[model samples]
Target chain A: MVLKVGILGGANIANKISRAINSIPDVAQVVVVGSREASKAAAFIERNKLVHASPVAGYDAVLDFPGVEAVYIPLPTALHVEWVQKAASKGLHIVLEKPIAIEDEHVDAIVKAAADANVVLFDGTMWMHHPRTAAMEAALQEIGPVWDVDSAFTFKGSADFLENNVRVKADGDPLGALGDVGWYCVRAILWAYDFTPPTHVAAHHGALFNEAGVPLNIAATLLFPGGRKARFLAAFDTVFTSKLEVYGDRGSLRLRDFVIPTAEHEASFVVATANGLADGDTRIATVEETRTVRNAVTQEAALWQRFAREIEVVRAGGRAPEYWPRIAALTERVLSAVLASARQGCALLPFEHRA
Target chain B: MVLKVGILGGANIANKISRAINSIPDVAQVVVVGSREASKAAAFIERNKLVHASPVAGYDAVLDFPGVEAVYIPLPTALHVEWVQKAASKGLHIVLEKPIAIEDEHVDAIVKAAADANVVLFDGTMWMHHPRTAAMEAALQEIGPVWDVDSAFTFKGSADFLENNVRVKADGDPLGALGDVGWYCVRAILWAYDFTPPTHVAAHHGALFNEAGVPLNIAATLLFPGGRKARFLAAFDTVFTSKLEVYGDRGSLRLRDFVIPTAEHEASFVVATANGLADGDTRIATVEETRTVRNAVTQEAALWQRFAREIEVVRAGGRAPEYWPRIAALTERVLSAVLASARQGCALLPFEHRA
Candidate 1:
């Protein structure tokens, strides 16, 4: 009774998730691969050596395939709304890749369709499922209420990538760098704030866009109630890094490899505790040390395993934990707010997701 | 040949620098300590064990004291311009504590008067003189053009301190947490940007103020030309921490104890390097390692030593380097812009200082 999963499109991310799914052989398997062109999908399966999966032409074929309980949609940002609705209609659960939808309205619609079909809908945010995330949360409890977060995820793409990559093309992934790298930054801040809505969203007034008007670089600040604030920076043309610092009333946690660990075996973060002012109130007395959390499998595999369990629950006629879709929808809501702020000349706007 | 220095006010920071100055008997000594009340100045000198210094009843007495070649003014923010001017008229070099003035306009005037008197005017920014700063600058070179910076300096103050501390009073330091702690945050960003003025400044909406309207918490963004930017967070009611990160085109640098080291004998920072994309572009390849920079004395002593050297040149009839004053003026210009943005309903404003 392996949870059969289908891969849609020959996206670069497909190879990684496919391998992750295959690793959890007893729980889930990549049962099929789908693409508009069958040859491209076949080439992708061959490249990743997905022996348990077969290739089919057209994305619809995967939705219609027998035993395909879930479809991992790695399609471009613009394609999620259509394919996800179709996949949900076919009663298949979803493992939609990040920037799940380009628009916030589309996010609610997509999630609602899945709920109507009684299928689990989960965004492919791998880090959220990692055991280290739980560890970081446990550490955060020592720090009291988190009031500040600073995060950055930037990658130095090839010159050709900035010029021609689908990520930077308005028609392909309209959110561009904001949709690509910034997705993690936004989620990290929201996670630190425990999913509470920010009162104001403002961009840093230094966003860069491609010729197609896709964002290449963006920086934004979110101000939550109770004087809590978060700032995030994302870029496609800058140095590669994933950094997060969460400061609370009593302590702080810093993770340099937050988005993706330097290695898959373990992840580490620094926790700093201070006794406050000392030495004539000129030097702050602080004690900082690193703590590591190790996982038996990679974070991506953990994500698949968790999603597979939810599918198992649904197959057994039990509930599929509704928080998954709720998190996805909330992340999309905040993501839209940041995009709106960036598009509106970096104006400060209220983060209102209710329609 | 020792540089005889006069201390203005019994401000908390004065104790630190007086100890710093008294440590180097060959280069400098605290010749006089001044306060509106003589007992307070005498107590400060006794507490800091400034054996060579005597107490004076008024600030003007120190400026007029025989053989006092320089004045270290750690008075409240509102008193700097008046005392600095009076001291300059007496041909005294000056080491003024940070948040040099309540307004940017006063910054130009203070520097202009110092230049006119041919006196060395160095701000009491201890970290600028630390050897770790030089090492950090050298490490930043590997990162290429720094495009982004994030820094924070915050302390969780007691209830009494927040209510009664002069820093929270409009007449004492109008800048409050911003002036007291954010001065370093602003200077750290400007230093990362090579003292270049930002084109725009905007503060986060989460700023908190005391009864006197002095900011207790503030967060801001400074946008330079070419889309380079920096974000700073300062607070009086948070877990104590001083963190800095500079991201450039090729790599990044992170310093946890950037404002004040955990230990005076040594300081450390992390430098991360990335090879851009890896694992089918799903994971970014990065390597981060920590580097330590040790100093023989605390940064405060180093600051006083550097300022004493400048005073030595002035006393020797050689021209003092003018860049120190320039950096101080530039930092004040940016600091005022952040406060203005915070006050103007957190509006985004141009960072203009030319008047």
Candidate 2:
């Protein structure tokens, strides 16, 4: 009953997923590892200690493998549309990395192909599957209505990474920091609003670009209906930071580590009650409460578990989950809008979904 | 010798300043209280336990009172220019409440009047005097070049406050939340950048306005020259949150209570080192350090002591302090640009300082 997962690239993230799959032996297993070079794929498997996975000569060989029921694509962003479309044509379930496509049309095509093939699809945003995320979702409901959200994800890239990494190349990953680090910030904001897309998007000025014209640092604001707003920043030149703040009418939720928890087994977020001046006093008094959630499995492993469950449901003659593709599409739409707005001199752009 | 001070307007904030003045009895003393109604001024003196102060019928009376060398003006936003000009003409040192004026022209008039009379002018943003703020400034230098700053200051208004508070009225406090709460966020951003104003400012969409066409909630982004940026949120309809995050190339600094510390005597901020995967490991390791500052005096009392010292220097034939008014004018210029951008449909406005 194990779901056979195939990896399409020898990317660093592929090694992480390979480990995650091996950790959850009851539900899923990595059956094939593919790369442009057979030697590279072999080395990746040997280095990761992926004893059960068989290294293949080319990406197409994994797609054409007889025992592969699903594929995990950690290839460069520019290659996502072609591989995802091909995987969908072969009726393979997909665990795609973020920044799913460089453009919305490609995302639409991949989504339509998956729908046509009746296959399960999920993005590789592992934090969404954590039990702590569920706890945070419940806490938000208790706090009255949320009105504002601020999130950021940043990291300092090494000199070699800036000079040689495919992520900084225009043709390799056109969105650059907007696609790598910014993808998480966009997804986090959308999740906080229950997958509601923004009505308006505006890129802030002062976005830094590389020699080839790909952004290295950027920020944007998303405006939703009813005075709800979110602001996010993404950078490849800053020290590592992952934080999110959700402000409600009656309370607030703040977490210093939202994209990736500081600890694997335990995570915590702070909730503050409405602030006010105490009776006959000028100083404000706000009561803060900390909430924690613990899980033995890593968030990445949990993500694979959920994907395996969805695959099982589809195999048993059930419909593919609509929520997964829906959210993925929304994330791409907002990101595309941000890029367009930034290109047009930081103008306010209307957010429209093709689907 | 004690510097004799006068209180102009019976505003609620005046009560807080009166207490701060009394706490520093060795340097400054309140000699007169002024209001539109003589009876109201007398009642305020008794209610606030200002036993050493005399009540005056009119604001002009406080300015004319003999031996009054300084004045603290806590009048409504619309009345700042008139009282500040009169007090300055009397050669009085002034402690002005924030949101100095509704328009740039008004702020210019006050600055000119103060300069003409050779008076030491200081704004009543008390948190700037906290010892922790100095410590934070030092930490920023250690962290390397700061490129991005995010700050917020929000508080929930009571029902009576929403309906009857002068802050919500167009003719009384006009600037509304942007002038009241947003003033702090703007100042913090400027301070973090060492008083260098942004080259461009843009108001984020989704600003909530009251019935009187004044903002109740608003957010904006400021872009400095070298890809350095700042974003801030100010709201009157949400729980109080005074947070600041500063990101640099080598590290980051974050604090939950930036506008007002959680306690009068102690404050803390967290610093995170640059993250990286440990040698031969896949997990990111970021070290977080907490820093605390303890003080014997409240920030407000410390602010008063500094203002009193500056007055003493001016009284001894020293030149008036230019740094105070210079920073004040820069804060107002950024605030005014935010309002202008919001009014013009979130347009990107150039930040121009008259001073």
Q: What DockQ, on C-alphas, does every prediction get?
A: 0.58, 0.52
**Model 2 TM-score relative to the real fold:** 0.97
Clashes of each: 0, 0
Best by DockQ: 1
lDDT at residue B282 of model 2 (Cα atoms): 33
Clashing pairs in 2: none
Native-to-model Cα distance after best TM-score fit, residue A347 in candidate 1, in Å: 2.3
Please report, as a residue range, the 10-residue window in candidate 2 chain B with the lowest summed lDDT.
B275-284
Report the lDDT tens digits of candidate 1 across residue range A1-355.
Answer: 7888899898888888977877789888887999888898889888988887788999989888888888999998888999999998898999999888888879888888888898988898899988999999998998788978888888778899888898999889988888788889989998998888788888876788887888898888888887788888888977777789898888899886888877778888989876555777556676777899989988999998888878888889987667888878877777778888888877789888553
- lDDT for model 1, please: 0.85
Score chain B of each candidate by TM-score: 0.96, 0.96
Instruction: Show where candidate 1 strays beyond 4 Å.
Output: A275-277, A281-284, B275-277, B281-284, B353-355
lDDT of 2 by residue, B1-355 (tens): 8889899988988888877778888878889999989889999899878878899999999999989999999999899999899889889999999989998988888888888888999988888898999999999998888888888888888899988999999998888999998998999999889988789998887788898988898889998888788899888887888878888777888887777777777888988766554423334567878999997787888888888888778878988888888888889888889989999988888887555
